[model samples]
Target chain A: MNSTDQNAPLLEVRNLSKHFGAVRALNDFSMAVRPGEVVALAGDNGAGKTTLIKAISGVFQPTGGEILLGGQPVAFATPQEAREKGIETIYQDLALADNLSIGANIFLGREPMRKAFGFLPVLDRKAMAEAARETMKRLDFHVSRMNAPVSNFSGGQRQAVAIGRAVYWDAQILIMDEPTAALGVPEQRKVISLIHQLKAQGRGVIFISHNLQDIFAVSDRIVVLRRGVQAGERKISETNHDEVVKLMVGG
Target chain B: MTSTSPAQPAEKHVAPQADHGDPATSLIGRIAEGRAWLFLAGLIICFEIWSRVAFGATFVLNPFNLQSIAIFAVAPLLLATGQTFVIISGGIDLSLGFIMGLAAVIAAHATNMAGAAIPLPLAMLAGILAAVIVAGVPGVINGLLISRLRVPPFIGTLGMFGVARGVAFLLAGGTTVPVRNSWFALLGNGRFYGVPYLVLIAAVFVIVMHYLLSQTRFGQHNYAIGANVQAARRAGIDIRGHILRLYVLSAMCAGLGGALYAARFTAGAAQAGEPLLLDSVAAVVIGGASLFGGSGTILGTVAGALVIAVIQYGLVFVNVEPFWQFIAVGVVIIISVLIDQAQRRFSGGRQDE
Candidate 1:
């Protein structure tokens, strides 16, 4: 459905492998995401979906293989490096400080500072508040108190705040790990709509979910993993839930 | 994908007021945040009434009584300032008390040696500098143990507490080390513009600390770390480095408190801050900082310290037994914690809705 599907891959993995001692958590896994496209990563428990995402997001180094971004081979030593290169990962646990305001959550590590009295540096609070307002507005999410701590928000709103953080930083590729797993039915739909919004903005999204229905709804293509390797890859239009489930379990 | 419009909805403007429909909760929230000041005001009023009824004298209006109370607050307030940062970071520095004692003993010896070779003002400065720097030794070790070795903060700091206490007593040669420097005594006892010089110094230090904890990036990161360390790590914050620096800063505060203690008493005692540790922690908690971390203010701690000082001084001023002061402070701490728990439940309930 993405008009820019013909565009060069925003993030590409070639024969990526990650091993932990005697265990081959992910082996020779490969995937590609293009601009304005949504790629669903679906697999059963312990199927190596987490390993593949973690490796791509720079949480762990691959035992073998290469990652290419924008057609150039690259490697990230840390998650911060990945983020700096426009690869943002939203974990299922949600990396948000519950006691902090949405704006504070948005700029946790990378706080913007303004000079006070033309010399001493201080937090630019006005800028943070304004950014929170604009970012949430851009996400089509509305909350009464922009300054309220994210803890007071519902699961869907908290998910939006995390996405808004990625959006505010202008991440080109988003890897969401089970983002809709814990949300209510309505909240899951809201998250799916948010993914659509991300696609409309020409950003690449790699959505990981257990729900085959959610994957079918938002993703253009699904990449299924089984036992640390690529199980099958299929276009949404060319496949159905039965076939995807078969790929997840293997034969 | 369909083109998703990014325009704001008309109803978006109405969201703020709609969520605030419960004005009573908002009012309670505001009061909770400022409860430290409220408690202090209430304490003062009670004391004022008691003084009028029982002693036929003024409690708050007397300049001497006010000065004595401010002096009483000084050491505890300084120790509490450091404790405030540590507590906000979701850690405790149990060694702060002995660290202050170690610095006090070191300051006395350093000042005596420096006085023999240097001018009076320079000697005083040298002593204070030496004490603060030396006090950072245990702090560095504390940081290393807790951050690098992955030891629990409580256990690590408790170990350091013993280490510092033993070292302080050893350095003091099992007795108080007397300082012969007149300048040190002047700094401790002298008054400027109707205020003690020590009080002025403390006021300035507290103001600077308030800025550090409220206006700076370090302060914000501190809150983030305390609120959720996993989130902070995910955000790319340098946790180990920050923890190391944080301990050093905390120790330096205790060091300054120790140096001031030596100046005030004109001697360095191994037990200089032994009794103040409890007071410092109590001040931070009474100020509304959650022991679990992520919530506290330096100003609130200021009010908390004043509350304790007033309780101690007011009780003595009213001819009440000094032992009752402990009971009164304990009661206030319980009351403050109860208020914190109630506020937490109130806000926590809204998350589900």
Candidate 2:
């Protein structure tokens, strides 16, 4: 059976809880995503899957919990902080600026800067274009023009651009929320393979999805969340689709 | 590493027809596609022809009339540039006109204070500074209300429209404040080697703001925020702060425009900038900047402002009643909007992929 290594998990959440007034969105939920692992986060609607992922990615701060990154306790007051710490999240809609150029979108907030006036800083377009080109070439990502708007790219190309952005920053832990939900069958398959490629690179990935088939095809470990709590954790080799389905639906 | 390239995903079987390699063909395509250039060129040509045939060419740019055209054009151009930022950022300021009026009043007061103790130059600086701050603070309030209090920009700025105008009147007691300094008069009427100082100042702002919109990270973020605010926030942009600054810029520009107008007339009346709000908006809208926001160019807006001036001046040059100028501008705004809607439908369909 597949088992988690004794080594520290890349990200460990201890009794994480988030309460929206009386909603109690997430209650004492805890999970771990480890290096070189594809941890499938399977949960039905309102199962706190979104809350959990958002908290981890710093979109929402858990009301009660301690999060350790690489065994070092960290607090992310903003997504930028989490990103600066080498953790990236691909939001459900890709969160890309549709009208901006690919290079501009990839390097949106953390643009490379040059000194324009003694100490004042301005965007270093040359350096940014060069970096974007080099990164795309290395990652084998095909964007027709670095200057073209992201809106022109297809659904699959947009996803790849999102992935390229995550990889460009050399994020250690990748959190993808329903990556293939809006994509077609062929695009879905492409994303699954991309997940495998990230795994081969020894990076940890937390894959959130509603599709049980996708969860089984790629995950090394499965973490099913139910009503804001961790209902079960399994080794994919030791679990079956029916059992995971029951766990997800709270049987 | 898995022999799977993320760039050429399996579903992406088609690539867009590549850009034409020929520079001349590509340039022609871009100009045609841009639409704004064509509309502007057409307006200029039509006006040139109308003036040449109906009236003597001198009516268009005679020695005395050139100054008037330069004078009337500068105010709308500055206000429209600021409004371009407002619209592209997905907001509108109904208070800009009144904000200008208030700034003019304050500037007039400061100019009158110039000869005593304060040197004339220092007094002008104080006047400009006073006007800018008075005008800019309402922008801050507008931003804070919209960002922190969750007030809609339209309502917030609408409230500011009344507040700024009321306060301007309260300060002035509903009267014009006149200045005694000829130096301030020189600012309004002074010529630097035959070029109006006002046009020179407005031109500088045009170049600077153009660079700001087209070349900076801040400019990119402005476009992004208006494009998809949620996406912008997710990308870790400080949306509230950036928007606040844009409003400040908008107000500062309006204030500058008003103060200059007051200097030219040597008096600050509470209603001095009454035409500012509508005129600036018309220029921005006619410039092809989307009222729905997220897209605009400074040069296009400048052209739009010039179109308004051309129509107004051209009507007078051709001996048409001056009131027809308003009707013409109203017609242009409608046509501009029609063009914008049509272009959005047209260009958005180009990527058949």
Candidate 3:
């Protein structure tokens, strides 16, 4: 793994808080992801992992706190704004349009256009197909039917396509929610390695997962949350599954 | 939930092989998607055989029969064109029928009023433009109800259906609005070189619709939203705005259909599109578009519409009861949906939990 000590943080959330009526969904949560590093967020159900990621990804306005990108404080009005600022959140089972091709999925909202007959604008299908081909290839993933709908692809392949989308748009920070949760063993392994490739490319990743093995396998640091608060943070090399589980369900 | 295994990178470099599996299955898949064309071809052959056996004449080769069928298809086809977009976006516009009727009434009134002081051709154009624009009003309401207010599509459009129908009838004073413009009548009834002007207009309109659905970003996004709206929203699509535009576009299509109807019969009836709602939706379904959304083509709907026209005209040509048209269309729609279901099961079998 490349040493991220010399690199500055790509994304930082300081004292973030979110509340829905009387319920504190997330409170006083702070984290930083540096270039070429993967930070795994570990928590049990209702421990505010989703809340934190949603707040960071612009799905929800934080009740209080600040998010900084490249040393500049930023507030995103919507997820689209976050994406434009290079923050992409790939929600589990909610990322790919099953009936669309990989290229179409990659260029969903922002489609490439070229003039036909020098006036009429049309979708640049050739450009989309070419980008899909190159993006998947760049991720070390291959699917033969580049134009086929993604419903034909397995779970892991779909995950790769989602990652390919992030890569194609040059997203600097990727927050993946349970990326491998729906995949088989081999497919899960494939997704882990895709994360490895992202880390190698100097992109920051916040991998939220319940699986300790997946978190430990690709992440450099792990942050465990309990009851909407940070329970513990540890280096992967220093912590084991038992200790992380203890942090998740504190006495 | 608690399975722990060391992650290995051995399988990382290996590409997942395409698992479409077997030539026969793929052949079935292809057949399923293009079944609308097959149905149209099969219907033609059947009609041709029936014509030869019953009247010793060829049904397909008769220019009069072909022309009549094309004319018969225009109104329904136009409505289906709009329905195709709505259905592909995972919604149905039930108000399109009354919307067409409303447009017809508006077109008749507008044309007659304009014809009193203007050139006939200009008056006809003004009528059509008015009908289409007025038709978009209900569409905007429908869009607001469905997209902004979060009303279910079926209920929302159905509500518009009643409202449009009542308004159209009220505007016409419960009678058909007779058009007085000679040019409007000529456009509806006249033809060039053995082809009806109505057919030509519809053909041009259909071609444009095909382009809009197949070649534009709006079309692609329609498919995306239908297939998985959450994914589309997350991908940064403006769902509410798109829905608003979509409904407006649909209403405008229906409006055009109504104006054409007013031209064809030289009168705009409040019920001009009352019977066509079912036919339009059937054409879309028969064309291979799923009502559940996301997988249809305009070309398919064309074939579907032609199939209905042929069924209606052919049944009449063969001396079948007029009521048989309803039964026959219903059967074909069911069969198309069955084919769609079988195809989905065949291909979507890989979507495992």
Candidate 4:
């Protein structure tokens, strides 16, 4: 890919709109995420940040408009399809299976399988564990053991594993929904560093958060959504938090 | 900022270091999470003791009697496996017993209609088909009502319980339908490699179910749905279709179990499995499956079924009245739930601390 191609936005939504009965969850919500940039999505609760993320991640098909990946229009019928197109989403709850081990949760839905020699095929646990360890290491995740069940991990470590799973799957566009909503200050810093690392790897990241301080620290650009419509998009260096908040409130 | 960073690192290190004082702490966590399996072991030990005291030996250890113990355990084992899937998906199929009974009656009627005229394979196929259809219809209905209409699975399956049992009685004229096919008798009673075919079938089901629950995408979705349906949906899982399939799969297993029962008995009574409803649930609960859903294993269900079987067999070995077996099963079920609650409370405390 040329510099233009490399710098080009990986995902672009144009005039997207979605209506849930009498309410419009999104309206003309257009945004673009360039490669190697962390775009912060900041809005008040119910300001359609989630709705926009869902639409882009293919959880809900937009009632109107086009989504472009690499400047070509693409439609995703399912989240799996979106995932196949290299869009990985880590939701607020992290979607970890508590009963399963950290490795299992990371490799859930897609597992490594060795060829069947006779009547039985085997799960390649060694390969999976090795890959899980590598992925965790790359993300700078320090945990007691990869064999331990995810329930044993603290909130921040769990979040790291969730992010690692997405990154390991080669997600080109990472959408994180409130990555540090409930974490303490140190944990928040850990996640922020991870986000920076994700952006540094030349992948586009859409960071949805209510914390403007964290947003300013990490985001190159900030997009504001208000009642299902795009309020504005501003370079993080140019706009103050009050202006962003005002735009988010539709003032 | 420097003091805070160092202090925070020290604090984080302290908590994990404290946990490291005993390498057994993590092992304890693992064991606690697997407390259901532990409880199962305890049950087995208790039964072993009772059997030795009553019969002057461990009855299950006797090679000649092992087949009988297995034969008696297969039906409930199959039923428990099916129930585990249903329950793990955050639903209960109360219709399981009735559906099994209905399947048995259907299979019997089919076998009788064939009555030496049809080829043995055809007759068996006919019986299996009849049972599958009988059990599958209600499953589809349950799935539709629960998935599309958003009815509570409890109400839908309970309603199915009544409907299926009533249909079985109507078809059998409120009595046991005699098995006229000789092959059906052989199928139920025959042995392969000294193991009863019915037992083999149940074992196969356990293996298949274990693979499905542990290795497949459907299994992951089932756990996800049970853990949190909304989250599963948000992850792009087809919650409705998956839930429908789960109910159908469960019912199909019940249907097969019923067929096995009819083959074994050479007759299909309307109330054949009526008493097994609670027993089946008891088996799964005893195996360590949560009633609230999201966690369980086929092995657990198998162990649970065997536990029930051992309790029943142990009672006979000890010359205790059969009626007391029911009370024992009831007591075991209560204790299993209490143990699960205690485990949860312990884990909850750990999480809080």
Candidate 5:
């Protein structure tokens, strides 16, 4: 491994731990995510990938250890607070309102409002639609229309919308959990391309996936978590899929 | 080489994939897509035919009869509007009838205590406040249990149903409380420009609700939470607060409806809105709102209420037995539910295929 110490990472975790009753979901795990980088998190089922993500995303507060963002010690009591601090997570389910239009889903909670005559406020649907179109275009996503309900969109298109939502909200650190899971080959390709696009935009991405091909394709580095602890970190150039799998199994 | 470009073959496949050939034109297709509106239209037509032909024809388009329909429909309209939010969020509030009853009793009692010297508006306000408070309690409980404790909404609201009804009976001493305020009657019985105040209030509430549900951030969150709660949570939505407010708003509306009912009748009877519970659920179902959550409209619920009211008036106009009106409502509810199920199944099949 090339040991190069550069500028501080965007996110750093030290001895982060969590216990669900008698079950130890995460234990003394540590990692760093630098800006403009994609770090793939791989582990076997029940290896605490979700727990670690939940801890970082503020879904489940860690029972111990500290999390620092931009080298400043911070704690998030709620996911909303975490989001405000630019830590956004996209779960495997995508967490989108399928009945809403793509534009609506993209701006679900924090919608832009237009002030007409200084008092009467209205939703800026046109502006939102335009932004959605632009964002999707930037990602090379060819959705036919922004007005269509998200339920009608294919899986790849929906993921694009989800990612667009997080990115549009100015999320500096993006944590995507199994984004390509349950998708077809073409859909997986679309998501991989989008991830690369996000990296190109200078955002730090923590990608969780079991597919090694996907990990090797988009990740700048791989962080394997074996049974709630960081097994090791491997640079994309220095490590092959087999070595990463071995580390994932704590070899 | 030019003829064998890879983009040409990909483009060919794209055209066929995009043109899945208009599923909207097929028999099951139209039903799956447009059944909600179709059911609403069909109900109106049935009521129109029955009110005009079966009845002695004197009631058709008559102002007095129209006013009666409005008065009869207002309670259900208010109840269904509240139910619309609850159902769209994939929950049910069966305690609405009891909550309404409690509100009626409280309003009547408060209005009477305010004495003859008090102005009618203040008395009305008192009643509204009382009902809002009583209704809000069950809502808070429902919200806490459903959101915080993770209790099933049905079980939570059902328990509230018993508690609220018992409170109503207890407060009223199991008897009717007569409202003596003359001005309070004006709200229920008075008319402005030929429109009954009762109908006008119902109209305003429906319009406000329609805008809130269709155009606001709150409405978006409601649908998101209803369609999938975990997804909503992951999206950083405050699910607990939203559900709490949803149930509170629903109960508050029911409370307001109860106050309106008390004004219309000049008496608060414990049993006044008992039948409304079933009718409200029926109206919501008939209006094409999904009980499973994530789909509904105020317009649909309004139409559903009108359909029910028209049926009731038609039965009275035709001099049919009172019990027959009950049977008719039951049949309507059953038919509406079946249509809803069929539409859901048809849509599900299409999505799977």
Candidate 6:
């Protein structure tokens, strides 16, 4: 059950489970995210945080679960299917095409196309560059060279580009897997701020992170998992870091 | 949620503007992008000067030599042009030469019966259709194996090489198939407005391929698929289908080259494509396309084929032994691949973007 407002949750995972051979990666998991909410996912290694995220984003299919979007049940056969359902996953690796221009990557699979002669449509590069610049501006993210390859971008900037790609496509649920790991203190902070910006725009977020400070900084609520099961769920205001830390570790 | 600002984004850390899109990537930027263009130009200049000094006049690009060069350059240029598509997609077609040879044999037999039994124009169409079917069908098979069956591109294409060659030999009965159609001869050898039709055809193909590689979504997908297959797939790019189509296009390009060869030579033989495989690959690499994949242009390839022409003309002009041409091409391939390796190292092998 959800809170008493009666509006449908933006994303709801009910009785979700994933099994890899004999390993139970996720067991009878359930969580809900409402509009404009940031739900932090916290756990140690092998705790099923990543597995659940992958299940939600269509990287891995949940062996048993009902993923309901706005009260309508959905099944994602591929990652593209999830994206079509307005769910975007920013994987740990960033998945940016390093060789393509920032604008190109921003509009990778879905480039602005115009028919040249007839029937054979080509990329309208001018349109792509303009749209990319526009979307980045909306995110308050700036890059001097929009036409340059992403391989030239710094680690953080590349992450920003990856996030921008989801935002540009109007993804309703942004699922970030380890959004802040391997980043500097400042780069990490930038990502945290970007998450706030995403929430401000009324998009729901499922943020998975090992950093307690980062999780505490942005989440409206925290869901803790341990050993492939839901350990606990707590409202940020109702619980402290020590309680969440204990839930993540074990008894 | 917390209202505090996130740390400053890392958007301002522009390093030394040594990247491809920088102004430093000017005409020198363009030339610096490919080893073949840089070395080929220097080679031509050196060959021209040496020819002028040694011979009474500049025999390097005289009309007689130029015509011969154009004729010889046609078949290989077509093959290299097609190879550009495959290589940029991080794939290769080792069977290209044999595919062309097979197309030529089919076209020869088809055209031989055209004037007497079929109409001349219809015969030409039949000849072209035969070439396309023979070459394109196998190419599709190669694509299926590589994409659907998970066969390595090198092995699949190499297997195609042997198969196509064997079929060509069987089709020709270990001999040349004579072509007698005068129209075929004209297209092969004749010219309008003082340009060899063969050269003209190659130039037109260059423009078409350049457009295909640079101006279309298909071209971008090729780069994307080659640059990073996983990223491409996650982007929802149909990698398997795209790769299948790419192999077909590659084989068909060789088919077109074979059709043209049969037209020009007035005969088709299994061994016709023996030298072409090495020559076309050399020309492609020399044109600035990487064998390691994800970067190449048809313009560069055409220029590369021209480089071979210049070398052949220059060597003959300098009275170099016939065997020296083979040695010279071998040396060129080695040097070009070396330069490509150095480029890969310096660019960190990640500039396909």
Model 6, B109-168: lDDT tens digits are: 888776678878778778867887888988999999999999988899999999999999
- Using lDDT as the measure, name the better of candidate 1 and candidate 6: 1
Q: What is the per-residue lDDT of model 2 for residues A31-58, given as tens digits with 9 covering 90 to 100?
A: 8777667899988899988898788878
**TM-scores of all candidate predictions against the true structure:** 0.95, 0.89, 0.95, 0.86, 0.86, 0.91
The weakest ten consecutive residues by lDDT in model 4 chain A span A1-10
The global C-alpha lDDT for each of the candidates, from Candidate 1 onward, is 0.90, 0.80, 0.91, 0.80, 0.80, 0.82
**Across residues A146-229, which tens digit of lDDT does each residue of candidate 6 receive?**
777787666667788888999999898999988989687777776887787787776789999988888888888999999999
lDDT of 4 by residue, B17-42 (tens): 11122455656556655655676577
TM-score: the better of candidates 2 and 4: 2
After superposing candidate 6, which stretches have Cα over 4 Å from the reference?
A: A1-8, A20-22, A116-121, A237-241, B1-29, B341-353
User: Order of candidates by DockQ, top first?
Assistant: 1, 3, 6, 2, 5, 4
Across B136-252, the per-residue lDDT of candidate 5 in tens digits comes to 888899899999998999999899999988999999999999888887888879999999998898888888898788767787788887787877776667889999999998888
For candidate 4, the per-residue lDDT at B99 reads 91
Segments in model 2 whose C-alpha atoms lie over 4 Å from true places? A1-8, A14-30, A61-65, A115-121, A237-240, B1-34, B58-66, B350-352
Among the numbered candidates, top DockQ falls to 1
Which candidate, 1 or 2, would have the higher lDDT against the true structure?
A: 1
CAPRI category for model 2: acceptable
Q: Which residue pairs clash in candidate 5?
A: none
Error of 6 at A112 (Å): 2.5
Tens-digit lDDT track for model 1 on B210-246?
A: 9999889899999999999999999989999999989
Model 1, residue B108: C-alpha shift (Å)? 1.3
Alpha-carbon lDDT of model 3: 0.91
Fnat of each prediction, in sequence: 0.53, 0.36, 0.55, 0.05, 0.29, 0.31
Looking at model 6 chain B, which ten-residue stretch has the lowest summed lDDT?
B1-10
- Best lDDT among the predictions, by candidate number: 3
